[model samples]
Target: MKTLQVDLGQRSYPIYIGSRLLEQADLLTRHIRSKQVLIVTNETVAPLYLQQVLDNLSDFVVETVILPDGEQYKTLDYLNRIFDTLLTHKFSRNASLIALGGGVIGDMGGFAAACYQRGIPFIQIPTTLLAQVDSSVGGKTGVNHPLGKNMIGAFYQPQCVIADMSVLSTLDDRQLSAGIAEVIKYGLIREPDFFAWLEDNLESLLDRDVEALAHAVERSCRNKAEVVAADEKEADVRATLNLGHTFGHAIETGMGYGSYLHGEAVAIGTCQAADLSRRKGWLTDADVERIIRLFKRARLPVEPPAALDANRFIELMAVDKKNVDGNIRLILLKSIGEATLPVGVEKALLVATLNGYGRKG
Candidate 1:
């Protein structure tokens, strides 16, 4: 097992990444603060791994909330179910929540821990690749609002993250590909050598080579931990982590959630960001093509939906968290490895990319 720390001083926590970690009860039990525990998972994951987690918590007063699975279910309405379970069971502030599914479960479970009795302890046992690499490490937790994605959330850290690689064996091909999108994001935003490595070894990752998957998860988590430690609240460098998220969030909110998986939308949005960067003379035509090819090779979508035109995208993007005083700021690429922080671009230029970048002339 390899352990990495988030390094938030008082809030610091370790992320345990390895195979069959669920079999290690101590890795999870040591983090729980009290006897009362709530395991928030979804219907899809409950049958597969819930019992393994339950096996570890046999001594605690445990309750389970099996949420309906999908991005569409990640809302204030569904989040209240966790609260209902907590309140019905009269769980105390010292009680810990175990988010035992993918990103939606992690986000909602963490948010519940953050809001219940003002705060409580929680641990993340992220079952999906997307959650393991991105959502689980960062303290950013919340449900999606109808107006914007992740607009109502908090920067609440987890007690510890258990990224058991063994659970990924049950993940479908599409969901596995979705996770690779975020893994690829780390390389695009900062790790140039990692990006080059991905170019050569993506096939190995697709084949679920144990060493390659472990390396990708560890390296991606390391990159995320370093950035979060420096700027926990996204005051500066942290915003760079949202490289394609602004446009991607727009896609999620515009199309209604779950139409595109979060990582699929990010892949498309990053391609658009590369297009805008090319327009601004930051990336060449070859650079844009290279970026698109990688997402394609990963089996992710690289084109924005035809249903969302420039005007609709603009409306949706205006509601983003990164926007300041109605100005829609975006994280664009300066190069393959270096990403610019959120910056305001000319509306005309932005419109041109939104209108022309992915559409046939």
Candidate 2:
């Protein structure tokens, strides 16, 4: 097993990445500060791996909340359900919440732990690639609001993150591809060599090559950990991680959630960001096509939904968390391996990019 650390001083935690790491009791038990444990998972994930986690935690007092699976379910109402479970069980502040599914569960569970009795310990056992690489590592936990994705959330760190590659075998193809979108984001933002490696190895990753998937997960986490360490509160540099998320979140909320996978929307959003970069004379047409081709090769959607137009996109993005003084800040590419954000882009250009690029005719 390979362990990487997210250095947050007092809040520092280790991310354990390897195959079958979930079967190890000590790895998880050592992180739990209290004897009480609340395992928050979804219906889809519980059937596959819940028992394994429970077996490892047999010694602790445990309660499980199996949530309905999907992005649409990530609401304040559902978040309340988690609190209800905790309250019903009389789980104390010392109780630890274990997030045991994909991003949805991680976000909700982490948020629950953060708000429960003014914060309690939580561990992340992310089952999906998207969660393992992105959502699980950084302490950015929250549920989506009707107005925005992750609109209501907190920067609460996890006690530890356990990513077991063995569990990934059960994931469907579309779900696996969705996770790769986040993997691709790391390359687009800061790792030129990693991007090149992905261009060559994306096929192997799609085929579920163990080494490729492991490398992708570890590298993605390393990149994310470094960024989060630098700006835990997203005061600066860390916002770069949302390279395509602003446009992507608008897609999720506009489409009414769960209609399109988050990673699919991110792939489309990355294409749009690349297109906007081209319009700003930063990326050449070839660069834009290269970006699109990589996403296409990953079986991700390269075009935005036909139903959303420039006006609708503008209205949706208006609520973006990165906006400053009402100007929607965007993370645009200066090159294939570098991104710049908080850009005060022209409205007309944004409108044109939204309408002209990545729009399905």
Candidate 3:
């Protein structure tokens, strides 16, 4: 097992990445603060790996809450279900909640743990690549609001994150592809060499080569851990992590949730960011083309959905949490590996990019 630490002083925790980690009870139980445990998962994942995790926590007084799976289910009503279960079982703040599925489960479960009794400990057992690489690491937890994605959330870090690469074998191609979007984002926003490596080894990634996937997860997590350690609250550098999130959240909220996977929206959003950057004369046409082509190679959408036009995008994006003082702040790339959050982008330029980039103009 390879361990990477997210150094947040007292809040610090190690991310354990390897194959068949779910079976390691010591790795999990050591992080639990009390005798009680809540394993929160979705319907799809419960059948496959839930029993195994329960078996590992055999000694703990454990309860399970299986939520209906999907991004649309990430709402206050469903979040309350976790609280309902915790209360019904009389779980205390000493008890630790285990998020046992993908990003949605991790987000909702972590949020539940965060708000329950003001705060409680939670561990992330992220099953999907997207969750393993991004959501499960950063301490950003919340359910989606109708107007925005991840708008109602808190920055509550997990006790530890367990990413079992073996579980990835069962994931469908679409889900696997979704994870690669975040991996690509790490490269686009920070590591140019990682981006080039992805350009070269993307085929290996698509094929699910064990080494390639492990490297991707470790590298992505390393980058994320460093950023989180530096700017835990997104006060500064951490905002770069949302490179494509502004436009991506607009797509998600406009589509009424779950219409497009978060990573899918991000892939399209990154393309939009690249286009806007190109418009600013920061990136050459070839640079933008390379970005789009890499996303296409990863089998991600390189264009925004047709249903939401430029005007709708503007309305949905106006409420983004990253906006400062009513002015929208965006993570725009100066080059492939460098990003900056520039404020007060002219509305006409943004509208033109949104309308022209992916639409049938």
Candidate 4:
């Protein structure tokens, strides 16, 4: 097993990444603060791995809440179910909640922990590649609103993150491709060499090569941990992590959620950002093409849905967290490996990219 730390001083926690980690009870039990435990998972994952997690906490007063699976279910309404379970059980602040599914479960579980009794301990046992590489490590937890994605959330760190690679064996091909989108994001935002490495090794990842998967997860987590430690609240450099999220969140909300998986929307949004960067003369035509080609090779969509016109896209984007005083700021690429922080672009330039970049000509 390989362990990485999110160095947040008092809030520091280790991220355990390896195969069959669920079989190791101590890795999870040691982080629990009390006898009361709540395992928040979804219907899809419960049948597959809930018992394995339950077996580990046999001695504790454990309760399980199996949420309906999908991005559409990630909302304040569904999040209240976790609270209902906790309140019904009379779980105390010391009680620890274990998030045992994909990003939806992780986000809701963490948000529940953050809000219950003001605060409580929680551990992340992320079962999906998207959660392991991005959502699980960052401590950014929340449910989506009708107006925006993740607009209501907090930066509550986890006790520890158990990224068991064995669980990924059950992940479908589409979900696997979705996870790779975030992996590719790290390279585009800052890791130039890693981007080049992905160009050569992406085939191995698609084949589910264990070594390649581990390397990608570890490197992606390391990049996340480093950035989070520096700007836990997204005061500066952290905002750069939302390279394509501004446009992507707009897609998610505009499409009424679950229509496009989070990673799929990100893949498309990143491509649009690359095109906008080209318009600003920051990246060449070749650079834009390279970005789009990678997403296509990963089996991800690089085009925005035709249903969302530029005006609708802009309206949705204006609800983003990164926007300041009604100005829709975006994280655009300065180069393949370097991303600019949230910056407000000229409305005309932004409109041009929105109308022209991904439209069928």
TM-score of each: 0.99, 0.99, 0.98, 0.99
Judged by whole-model lDDT over C-alpha atoms, candidate 1 comes out at: 0.93
Report the lDDT tens digits of candidate 4 across residue range 1-361.
Answer: 8999899999999999998999999999999989999999999999999999999999999999999999999999999999999999999999999999999999999999999999899999999899999998879999988877898888899999999988999999899999999999999999999998999999988888888898999999999899899999889999988988888988889988999999999999999999999999999999889889988999999999999999999999988888899999999999999999898999999999999988997
Model 2, 1-361: lDDT tens digits are 8999999999999999898898799999998888899999999999999999999998899999999999999999999999999999999999999999999999999999999999999999999999999999889999988777898989999999999988889999999999999999999999999999999999899988877889999999999999989999999899999988888999999999999999999999999999999999999999998999999999999898888888899989988989977778899999999999568789988998998995545
After superposition of all CA atoms, the RMSD between model 4 and the true structure is: 0.8
Cα miss at 186, model 3 (Å)?
Answer: 0.6
Per-residue accuracy of model 1 over 1-361 as CA lDDT, tens digit each: 9999889999999999999999999999999989999999999999999999999999999999999999898899998999999999999999999999999999999998999999999999999999999998879999987787887888899999999888888998899999999999999999999999999999998888777888999999999999999999989899998988888998988898999999999999999999999999999999899989999999999989999999999999998888899999999999999999999999999999999888976
Candidate 1 RMSD computed on C-alpha atoms after optimal superposition onto the true structure: 0.8
Candidate 3, residue 5: the lDDT equals: 90
Stretches of model 1 off by over 4 angstroms after superposition: none
In model 4, the runs with Cα more than 4 Å from the true position are: none
Give me the overall lDDT of model 4.
0.93
Q: In what order do the candidates fall by lDDT, top score first? A: 1, 4, 2, 3
| Candidate 3 lDDT over residue span 1-361, tens digit each | 8998989999999999898898899999999989999999999999999999999988899999999989999999999999999999999989999999999999999999999998999999999999999998889999987767787989998999999999999998999999999999999999999999999999999998878898999999999999889999888899999998899999888887888898999999999999999988899999999999999999998889899998889888889888877778788999999888545688888998998998885
lDDT of 4 at 215: 91
